[model samples]
Target: MSHTFRRRFAALVLALSLLTLPARALTAQEAGQLLQDYYIDDVSQEVLAQPTIDAMLSALGDHYTTYFTADEYAAFLASMEDVQLTGIGVKMQASENGPVVVEVLAGSPALEAGLQAGDLITAVDGVSTAGLEMGAVSALIQGQEGTQVTITYLRDGVSAACTLTRSSILVAATSAQLLEDHVGLLTCTTFGHDTYAHFTEALDQFPQADRWIVDLRDNGGGLTQAALDTLSVFTGGGIKCYFMDGSAQLSALEAKREQISSAPLIVLTDGGTASASEIFSAGIRDLKAGLVIGGRTYGKGVAQSVLDQYTNPELFDGDAMKITTVRFYTASGSTTDTVGVIPHLLVSPDLAQEVALLLSAAPPSGGTAGYYRLDLNGSWYISQKAALAQPEVFAQLLAAIPPTAALWQGSGDGWNSVQPQQAAADHSIPFQSRLFSDVEGSPYAQSIQRLAVYGVVLGNGQGSYFPKSSLTRAQLAALLAQALNCTVPTGESLFSDVSMDDSYGLAINAIAKMGLVEGVGNGLFRPDDTVTHEQFFTIMGRLAQRVSLTFQISRQGATQEDLDSDRLSRFAPWSRLSVWLLSSSQLDELDQPVSLLWDDVTRIDPTAPISREEAADLLCAVLERTGILPA
Candidate 1:
């Protein structure tokens, strides 16, 4: 049998096995044991000691780890495939008194029965839904096909009751259409069991299209295998993701099928794009198969292993647990866990598809008569006319795009490429200035601008640099990582207070791995605490040491009286050495102390917090002293 057929057959068999499995009751202890054995992290005995399975799972604080009863398991399994469930079909959310109807699907029984959005469902078959969970309310509404359900709802202060027959409704997991310019647009709402097949069907309908856009915005992920299979259709066989469990070993998830189309692919993403959706996005990017354009994706890098009676007949009868078993990474060993996959082109989610379409346009044949071809980081063919239509967004993109972005201009096959600024001046497109609006007057302005051009430092969104603010631990780590071009680690952090979810956790881990930083105590890296002058100097000293530079002054260079001065004594014994090193070290050509304290002075105060400007000066000084940065 074909690999695709084998995969589908396996999925079908798994679903069928779930239905035929014996309904046996599982003890809470068994559930806890299963979780302890297979969960991504080791569980403490205290957490597992919770009286019930639900309590144990909840205490872990892993929202993805869930225990499902037989009926719930059936629904869970069904949700992984195309939607075909017996329901009245009104999407609802829990409210104070009952569930509020949010949406009514077209041709659904609820819509036919005159239910509308904003209607509060008070009861289901005379049973009050007040304060019930959404799952409970849904369970009360869905039943066997042809079964009748009575729903009591309030519409604008008036109560009404309706009895409707539930029917099977099919919601397509994937939708396809040929868009303007022959670009095939495939929107996948989920990575379901049949999603790969649906994608292939979509591709078959648009064989003539040379470019395709896969829109994954707001697509909460589903089956991992489904996502891999669908990605295979575009990228052919390769490693889709890397999985690391409690074992701490990276394992590759390979796509085994040949590609269906060699057309240039573009992926659209948003903050709501997660999990299997992320898997597909990362695969497209890492495999060099497509370009991702949109907002940062929802960072969901962990995969859950669903265990049930069908798989472990001896342990579970009907109930099952979906436990987080591993953290997944990109094929390049980078993670989309807390640090989501940042798009190559970051546009508003609403405009992502439009921008992608613009990017997919071929370079003009007649050589740019009405159009100007632009290239940003190898992604090309954005036209000036189309860009000018969305001036505000184009300005935003121009700001984000590097200053090195090239532009082509001419007429009738005589196009000439020019610098971005030159092209912007010629075409009247606004460009971002390298200097911050507020930093031109700061003492460290020159250093900050240099770093900014190198992409080491960035201004706050409003274009101002908060130079007076004290630098926090997290911010320091991020700056150091960027300045050094450190490869941020994707594994679990060593510090207890930092998780993969923390914005700067990856940077912290990266610096920690380089032995330039450490936790304060008790395995806690106080990421929010401000960095003191002494602490900053110590880290700089470590950095200098790593690069084989010696900043420490010998006895001949500094007298015993100078070494024992109160200024040096104020610092901690362990920090005094680094402080002295920094105070004595001079810039190569300038012959000035590397340490820049308050008010641009060389004096060091061990206890005082370092301001943002001071930190920038200090970093530049260190880099210059060590020959890492041009003096």
Candidate 2:
């Protein structure tokens, strides 16, 4: 036979063998019976099956959707509940100048590593990112916490290398301040699980304030329950708010608790405050809780209930759609749906400086001014003063509010575990030679091990846990996903270069959805990219946002100082994220960056990819600092 004819014969035989195997594998009788049972009885079955099969096959033509399955559905739910994932902290868009950083979160590893707004990311790691789509480039930059990623980019005319350690990046939700004047300022980013708690905590400390200012600007809403809980504080046994289900009226808020405070209240709102934030604001305004301030609020009075099955069992998980089931109404039966609550005191961002002018003409005792000084003893001392005679200086001082609370002197001393070196000497244990034995007996070991067991750390990839390798972007993202028990997406690759088989593909997709990172261009995703120190800080900042959104405490009247500043630092980008979260209110103090203590970098290697060892150490450190890990 000719060679071509022989090859064709072999190919035919292979095709026949492939087709024949399935029948043999399933027993011909059983296969035939099953087919007959489902399809042979009716012509409709045969016709419908063909169309259904055709539709399924056509859907698979787009690789992105081909991978969807029952498992994928669960994974999608997990992503939404957590609301965010890990990656480098930078907002990117296809601008006229090409992909540009729109905003850089303050105190993120990105900022620490020297990546700035307007700096063009030309490459990720060593791969040229040219022509790659934004999402693909973002995938390259995100990863497990503590893993290192390298970024090569151009700033001005200079080429530079920045290594960033990805950490769990969270979007912030609530920010509060006891303004120098006795007015309490609170900003809610979103109405998530913890928002009410955060607000309560802020309020509890400032019960004596004369007036309160609630800032809900730029707050895109979240959980309905959160909004109800927030509104409950200011309302008496009155109709808190109502929801309209189609044409029927549904009472969403039946007064659960008696009103906590009825002090003169002022709510600041803007275009960014929508959904649950609007509901809460409108409830207060209608119930006579406070005065509404600032620009017009975003009109998102519709309520949505999300059912997600993939989230942690402790969270709301089920197959649920966030459909607009109800339209929110104020206590007075007025609809603030598309037409949001107009502020009783309309203060525009541009006119914010005129607050002094507005105040000067008002009553003098209505507002008070003060400065906070942290004593070496950990006690915060408030120095009362009259409102500043100079308007510009007062605004500058307010603008300089520390992004995070000052380190409490008592915190380090109270929670400090004996240093390993000191503990060894004090206990008469040998230091280096008996390291493992010492660790076994050390009280701090349990806390460290807990973090490790939680998948927050996996030692170094090698058998030895280096404990000091700098964290990289990829490593941090992985650890964060693990810590949150985030469901990562899997299937055909979304980027041109990233294969479906790549191990980190799911995580990359999760982070991309969270808006923590962005791509360079084209369809490439350089997963092996290293990150810079500044980028690491930005990732922490993003994590802070998630933390704030997920966890919140309520406070009564507004005060001049934040009580939870130290807690916010673990999520480093709290300052900027706080702004986005609380864009509605008059509290502008949180929009500024806070200064980090000089020694904050000792635990992190600023130049290298944050390694697994570093991630473990940092996780332990945070847990310890937060008192989650016992001393």
Q: Which lDDT values do the candidates have, in the order given?
A: 0.73, 0.48
TM-score of each: 0.63, 0.37
The residue-by-residue lDDT of candidate 2 on 274-359, one tens digit each, is 77787777676655565455656665555543222222122222221222334566554445544455544334533432342223
- Residue pairs in collision within model 1: none
Q: For residues 279-313, what per-residue lDDT tens digits would candidate 1 score against the true structure?
A: 89877876777778887788777878776655666
Which runs of model 1 end up more than 4 angstroms from their true locations? 1-22, 85-169, 376-379, 392-396, 409-461, 466-631
Indicate which candidate wins on lDDT. Answer: 1
| Model 2, position 138: C-alpha lDDT score | 84
lDDT of 1: 0.73
